[model samples]
Structure formats: C-alpha cells, structure tokens
Target: MSAVTIRAARPEDAGTVLELTRALARFIKAEDWFLATLADVERDCFGEAPRYEAWLAEVKGASAGLATLFPTYSTFKAKPCLFVDSLYVDETARGYGVGKVLMRHICQLAVERGCVRVDLNVLNWNPARSFYTGLGMQETGELGMTITGPAMRSLAGLD
Candidate 1:
C-alpha cells in the first residue's frame, strides 16, 4: 500500500472534491438530492471568508478521499467544536484505511485548533456507523430534522 498523504484542499482541487462528494451521495442513494456543483465547492471552500475547510487524501499521488468541515461553538462546553460536514473515501480506496486516516487527520486538526469535541451526523443505515464507532464516536440517539426548499424559504419569510 502506498503511503497516504493528507493535505489542505486548494482551488484546483474543487473538481476532485465534487467528484468524491457525488460518489458519496450516489452511494447513499441520495444523488437526486445532491445539488452541489463544482463552482459551489470552489466558492465555499476557496473563496474569501471561506465558510468551511476541505482536506484531501492522496495515495500514491492519486486522490483517495476528502473531508469537509467547519467549526462551531459548544455553548455548554464553553469551547469550540469541529463539525465534519462530509467524509468520504472512494470505492477503490476503501479497505485501505483511507477513511481512518482522514478521520484521524480531522481529529488532529481539532486538537490543534483547541476544539473541545468533534461532531458529525451519520445516516442510521450507513454501514460506516461501525467505522465511526471504532474511532470512539458515539451515537447521540438524537433525530436529525431539517426543513429545506420551499419550507425553508417560507420559514425565512422569503416567499
């Protein structure tokens, strides 16, 4: 196995990030709901006042995985928390410890940033739940709710 190298994603990596993201969405059977574009990736990750940060994992100089995350405040802990928005490893890269490496890198970054914890939402049926649990992540037993599309617009009184 070639050594895996993880690094911060740059503008030129937008396409790679989007490709991996689409693959993930497809894996979860949510491709119909995956509306993100390459432009969105570039803008959100590399634009001024970046809303989030992205990291890429490469094995033998080939893209293997990617992680996108942002920081949030933990009012209860009185410290910041790192929320991993997405973590994915390509099919060809699975079983090679790429996901584990990416996750550990995220945790290391959280520690270096003085974050009190790391957070992420995983689908109930995702088999990766076991992988996450293996990394010491516990299921919160909380339901995730969302209101998007017209409902969100109406809630914001944009209609």
Candidate 2:
C-alpha cells in the first residue's frame, strides 16, 4: 500500500467523495440508506453555500477515502465543535490505515479551528466502534434519541 495523503477536498473531488460515501454505506450494510448523489454532494459540499467541508485520503494519487465534517455548536461548552458527518474508505483500502489518517486529519482540523470537540455517530453494531474507542472517544452513556417521520410530525403539530 502506498502512503496515504490527507488533504482538504477540492470542488473537483465531489464526485469521488460521493463514490466513497456509497462504498462505505455498502460496507456497513446500509446501501439502502445511501441517498446522496454526485449532484447532491457537489451542491452541498462545494456549492456557493457549502454546507460542509471534506478531507480526502489519497493513496498513490488515487482517492482512498474521505471524511465530511459540519460545524456544530456545543451549548454547554459555549463553543463550536465539528460533527463528522461521514467517514469512509474504499474496501480495497481498508485495514491499511486510510481511515486512521483521515480521522487524524479531521481531528487536526478541529483543533486548528479552536473547536471544543469533534463528534460522530456510529451504528451500535458497527465493528468500527473499537477503532473510534481506541482514538479516545468515550461512550457518553446516553442513548441517542430522535423523533422523525410521523413521530416528528405529531410532535410539531403538523400531523
């Protein structure tokens, strides 16, 4: 495996980022939930109002993986944080430290931005939990709660 290079993603890399995202979704058995397309990725990640920033991992000049991050606020800390929206590595590039490089790059960016912390969510059954844990991310001991679809509609008085 070649040395993986991590850098901020450019506009031209949007398509590649989307491809990696789909590949990751498939790897995690959530291909059905993969809803992003090149158009969406380009618009949201590289458009004038860019909703997120991305970092790419290149191995021997080929895209190996990517990590997308969005700005978030920590009410308690009264500071900004980064939410890692997605991190994915190509199947062929897995276990070669591509993900680790991407993660470290993301952490470095967070620190550079003076963020209070970086946060990400992983499926409970995900095998990658160990990897995140090893990176010093502790389990908060609080289950994630959500209200969506009809539940959210009813709560919002829209149903």
Candidate 3:
C-alpha cells in the first residue's frame, strides 16, 4: 500500500466525505440512522463559521478515510479540548494504518492548538475500542448520555 496522505478536506471533498459517512453507517448497521445531506455537510463543514473540521485520508490518490472533530472548553483545565465526532476508514483501507494516522493527526492538531486533551467515544461493541486502547486511550468511566428528538424538544421547552 502507498503511504496514506492526510489533508484538510476541501469544500470539493464534501461529497466524498458524505459518501464515506454513509459507508460507515452501513458498516455499523445504522443506515436507518444516517441522515446527513450534502447541504448539511457543505454548510456545517465548509461554511463561513464551520461547526466542525474534517480531514480526509487518501491512498494512491483515492479517498480512504475521514475524521471530523470540534473544539470544546474544559473548565477544569482552563484549556481547550478536541472532541472527535467520527473516525472511519473504508473497508478497502483497513489494516493500512489509515485510522492511526488520522488519530495522530488529531492529536497533533490538539497539541498545536494548546488543547488539554482529545476525547472520543466508541461504542462498547466496536472492535475499534482495542485500537483506541492501543493508542493509550483509557476509559473515563463516565457513562455517555444524550437527549434528542422529542425528548430534546421537551427539555428546551419546545414541546
């Protein structure tokens, strides 16, 4: 395999990113939950005020993987942290270290931005848990939680 190159995704790459996103959803058997559109990707990732940043991995000039992340504050540390929204490698690109390269790129970005930490959540059943552990990531012991859909609306008094 050729050396994988990682680059900040350009607006032109939005479709490729969205395609990989769907592939990831399919891989995780969550196709029904995948709902992002090209417009969403374009606006959120490449707009004037990007909600997040994305990087793409390419091997031999072909798209292979992607990672999306955003910054957040850690009041305790009084510094910024990066939360990885997703890290996915195409099936054809697995075992070629694409995921590891992307993760290292995220960490490198954190360091450059003076971030205190980098965080991400992986499903308990995901085989990538071991991959993260291998990179020295440890379980924080805090349960992940979320509120969405009608429940989210009710919390915001929109019900």
Best by TM-score: 3
Clashing residue pairs for model 1: none
Q: How many backbone clashes does candidate 2 have?
A: 0
lDDT per residue, candidate 3, 1-159, as tens digits?
Answer: 999999999999999989988998888888999999999999999998999998999999999999999999999999999999889999999999999999999999999999999999888899999999999999999999989899999999999
Clashing pairs in 2: none
lDDT of each: 0.93, 0.89, 0.95
- Model 2: lDDT of residue 94: 90
C-alpha RMSD values across all candidates: 1.0, 1.4, 0.8
lDDT of 2 by residue, 1-159 (tens): 989999888889888888888888887898987889889989999999999988899999988888989999999999899999888888789999998988888888889998999999888999899999988998888887777788999989998
Local error of candidate 1 at residue 157 (angstroms): 3.1
| Model 2 RMSD, rounded to 1 decimal | 1.4
At residue 121, give the lDDT of candidate 1: 90
Cα-based TM-score, every candidate: 0.96, 0.93, 0.97
2 or 3: which has the higher TM-score? 3
lDDT, residue 154, model 2: 96
| Candidate 1 vs candidate 3, TM-score winner | 3
Inter-residue clash pairs, candidate 3: none
